[model samples]
Target: MKKQDTLSPYIHFDRKDWAELRSSTPLTIDEDDIKELKGLNDELNIEEIVDIYLPISRLLHLHASATRELYESRNVFLQTNVKKVPYIIGIAGSVAVGKSTMARVLKALISKWPNHPKVDLLTTDGFLYPNEVLKERGLMEKKGFPESYDIAELLHILSDLKSGKGRVEAPVYSHITYNIVPSRTQVINRPDILIVEGINVLQPPKNGGGKEIDQISVSDFFDFSIYVDADEKTIFQWYIERFKLLRGTAFRNPQSYFKKYAHISDEEAFQVAESIWNRINKVNLRENILPTRHRADLILRKGEHHFVESIKMRKI
Candidate 1:
């Protein structure tokens, strides 16, 4: 645990106590639905949902409702008509820490609330510079690193989204091709809630610039945020396992970007995956992702088994 964890401006909760906070929150999704929501090699149990996710979902529901009311009240006070934009929620974490699964599950739960709030999910993988750009910059080996993303473009999209812009288009990233899909875009119109999930979403702006400089970051637009956490060993194991699993699955596809590894034996796949993880993902996590954990509104700390055993929430 970090030193700041025990300090003020935050409230710590064990899993049991947190689960009680769920009290009357209904379980809207079933086991069958969760199966589809889980990421490859990720674990998602109904009990985990009832314990951890439900409470957070309920909390977000209340927050969103309150935010909407405040927005309406401000409009009335000013005696002017203003467009209400969607409440943006940011989710940040390291690779293979079950963050994608958390985002999907949260979307499923939050979208099923009483009013059935319209929820849209946007992953920042699309905001990564196109493959060619990475190659041009000689950063293919640092693909998930902070410097690899198109930060300016990401901030522009967030600015547009927060200003109640209609029909903002986001680039689409393809896993099979490991590149941005040309001519394809995911148009995001206004919704009740928008979940922006990525590894670097919580990063601070004005990197290396003096404190005097004014800057904007994508996180500035978030109404709420979450950081998924797990030990390095656990995440490393998960990543390697995911790579091995994909060898027999996604990697085998003829058009797969990793098709070259599809026929590699288990030992070879493990070694390659380990090398990639040690070189790229680990460094990115240590240098960029993990440092932003303290900036999240909430942190979901997972045990080795991939279940969140505790949560740390910043005081509202």
Candidate 2:
């Protein structure tokens, strides 16, 4: 264990120490279940889940339990029935850093708890502006950048969810088509738990007209948030690997927007992938995503092999 420095709000733990905190948390997921939860080219297994994620699930369960108690207490004091709002959890990270896999695993594990049996997973990819809009705005090449998202609509949905809306709908995005699917929507019912995952979920509100309004950012609605961290060099490697894997799989589909890459040679594909990463994703990570990491309630730091090495959790 590393010694904590004074004035730091985070308590740090190495992987071995963190795994011991699992205590009596049971592993509810099996091998077959993990296969369905893992992202493309991601390395995940039962051991990692038991050591890394089981403890997280337990922590979330505790948080959710406490929140419900608090809400009930408030209602009793007011002597009125108040609607129970969903507990929102945000997962943010650089592209190809496995935020999607983490979100999926948490959704499955946390939903199994008796207290919050209803869980829903939502990704911000669906909230990105349609390709036509991006092209019209001349932001087609900056797809993953914060400016490429429909920020106002995303805020409206979160606000509605937090206000205890019975039903809310979000647009559906398709990687094969590389655009928002026409007329398709994901219906979010009133769930006990909601996981919102994306690269820019933690971004601070931008100042409009040289003045800051008292408006709430998307992250302000979150009861808990996590940031997945990895070195820039290693993440670049994972991005390239995922691109190659997709070329052999999803990109080969005739309807896929990236189908053109499937016909290219390995060398050509690598060059293209590298170019895209250097020109777009890398810049977005450094300038936007990485800067917001410190705002997370929990930070899962990964090592070279895509395994989590340590965790830094906010103590206050």
Top candidate on TM-score is 2
| Whole-model alpha-carbon lDDT for candidate 1 | 0.89
lDDT of 1 by residue, 115-154 (tens): 9888899999998898899999999999988789987777
TM-score, predicted candidate 2 vs. hidden true structure? 0.96
Runs off by more than 4 Å, candidate 2: 209-214
Reference-based lDDT, residue 195, model 2? 97
Angstrom error of the Cα, residue 188, model 1: value is 0.7
TM-score attained by model 1: 0.95
User: Tens digit of lDDT per residue, candidate 2, span 99-123?
Assistant: 9999999999997776548999999
Backbone collision tally, model 1: 0
Model 2: which ten-residue window has the lowest total lDDT? 207-216
